[model samples]
Target chain A: MVEIEIDEDACVGCGSCVDDCPNDVYQMNEEKWKTEVVKVEDCMACLSCHEICPAQAMEHRDIHVAKRLYIDRKVNDVLDKII
Target chain B: MDMEIEEIRGTFRPELIPKETGGDIEDYEEALHVLMKFVGSMSSALEQVSGRGANAIVYQAGKRMGHDAAKMMEKTDNLEQAMKEMGEVLGVEFYFEMWKPSDQEGYTIEKGNETVVKLLFMDCVVRQTLRRTGLPQKGPLCYLLYGYMVGAVEEVMSIKGKLDIDHVGPNACLKTLTIKWGGK
Candidate 1:
């Protein structure tokens, strides 16, 4: 089951990835189409969306890495000021 | 500087700290170093690319895009070579030149005599895939890439307190070169 993850902050709502994916795996969410896990078996693991993400946002991971990276930005912002 | 950084780190993004690069500003600095190395390597490789007389312009955008990511990611693979090989496989040739305000071909100012580095990169040809994709077309790419580099220096790098970008290309023949800042 391929899970969909969206970092709304990074999702510029550009919708480029939606056009690139062939498996119909993503869709527009709240107008942005920010990385929806629409299909499980269809994922080709092409990394097209990953490479194309201009904001360094979005990724297909084993759910764990996805969750961790999702929070990394916020953490980095706080830590960046101190250590 | 250390004390100043500590004060700044006090307001950092806590969540990003532990996961990506061990939660420290020190690590972040190290990451930026790595990222710059990657970018430099990419820039160097671009010098060899030819662009096949295809009428193209290439430049780096989102000034911090390459820098911030470069600082964090640890690349074990030869991406420089990989990018080169990717060009070969795709039958596209590219060229790039990295600059600083102090280098040769470096323009000189009249009165103040202050030298400032204006970083830039340009492509010699537009790729077939890009042409078909309906992304921002080449003309806009030229405009934005130039503006983006100025943003990088003035905003991201914080080298200059304030700077403005100026463009001077879309030449009579095949290409365009945008000049950033007030020319000499």
Candidate 2:
């Protein structure tokens, strides 16, 4: 399981990660360019955004299946509506 | 310069490189134009529209006097606090933003005693609101301050390779700057 982290200060609000994520895990907040983790759990272990991000603002941590999988499933539940 | 020592230092990542392979002088100028506009837009949006002027105005903060109360910070001492109070009165702020190429993964540079992290592009903005205080314009001081920042950044870039960091445009309202890496 993977834990996703996004640095609000580092994020440029480019929306690249939002578009690239196949799992539909991120969304842009209205006020700022930063992405809000509306669905933390939907992350599919795919690191496309991690590799593609130009800002070096995103990171992931590998964790036990129990802790990691919970966020992944929780996020995916919300992903259906936004994506 | 000796009397005033108020300063803040920062670094940005991913050294910026030209998108094109080779070009003439016009190309270089155009690149700088694009870079300047990019930084200016970001700065204007943050300074003018964001309602975060206090944060953006670094120099103004330098002149502040007689502050009421705020929690003490461990990292800062009394003298530093006093200087900060003065800064608050002056209404000065320095803001920096950086853009860099992703492939290089960013790097750092060392100057006399400073180490600067390389960025694709870095913009150091100095906003001074003097309020027509009958004081001589501090434009030169602002330019000099930013010049030091650029020099530090260039020192870092030079270690990796020769990059030409130049002041592209200088206007009263704003200035345009750019650092071009690699030779034509």
Candidate 3:
């Protein structure tokens, strides 16, 4: 099962997610002008909404996170120390 | 910034197989990154030189490889069974599963002589390589996996098949695989 959360404060109501999601997992709350998850059952956790969301308001939980082997560990290590 | 290089000397014989592989995890990571860069460069250069023809070349190469890999597998007419076998063949590097919408009762839909199934690719090396090289998705490189899946399915089911990308994301990608029942 996939759980999605949208921070209302962060949501700008751009409807980017609503348009970008192929599965129709999200819809804009027209009254509140915020984004909401409408069809949670169909969400595949592709995270395209997360990428397109300017405010970064959405979060997905309990989904299979794909492996990110492209990241350079040494660069991250250096940044960890500096930050 | 400076590192030490360790060298191993061993005698090699055709009949004797080495039980252990040389180099550590770091070496492997370095090698993997280098290969990704090399492949990325090749894909980009090929695209620039060959234009759209690059995709066909890469797809043919992948199809040949897929056919070769599927040669040892058992042939079957069942799409689901063939998908299971393909999952094992693809392994974790290109992990994928049949997907369907909540409203759909079955994973597959039949339309006349054609059967269509949605595939959700969760982990993919081509995606990783593209990200590593800062290349966009749906390029010629993506056709490699497309051809691979189509080729494998064709070999396993003895039917003509095609795969189409529906969407691409950082974590996952969705594709549609259609098989023609008597198109072999």
Compute the interface RMSD for each candidate structure: 19.6, 21.5, 0.5
Task: Write the residue-wise lDDT of candidate 1 on B3-75 in tens digits.
Answer: 4343333444778776555347756755644554554344334434634222122334433332332332333
| TM-score-sorted candidate list, best first | 3, 1, 2
TM-score of chain B of each: 0.26, 0.24, 0.93
Give the lDDT of residue B22 in candidate 1: 37
Better of 1 and 2 by DockQ: 1
Highest TM-score among the candidates is held by which one?
3
Q: RMSD, each candidate, Å?
A: 20.1, 23.6, 1.7
What's the lDDT for residue A59 in model 3? Answer: 90
Q: TM-score per candidate, in order?
A: 0.24, 0.24, 0.95
**Per-model TM-score of chain A alone?**
0.59, 0.66, 0.96
Which regions in candidate 1 have their CA more than 4 angstroms from the true location? A5-15, A27-37, A44-79, B2-39, B42-45, B48-184
Task: Judge the docking of candidate 2 as incorrect, acceptable, medium or high.
Answer: incorrect
Question: Residue B143 of candidate 3: its Cα lDDT?
Answer: 93
- Model 3 clashing-pair count: 0
lDDT of 2 by residue, B1-184 (tens): 2445445444433453344334566456546545545544444454455454523242233212111111131222222232233233222223222322233343333445333332211122332212111112233224333343333323333311222222221111222223333411
DockQ scores for all the models shown? 0.01, 0.01, 0.88
lDDT, candidate 1, A1-83, per-residue tens: 44546688888877777776645666767655465656645553444566566886675664212111112454577799999
Task: Please state the error at residue B119 of candidate 3 in Å.
Answer: 0.4
Which rank order by lDDT, best down to worst?
3, 2, 1
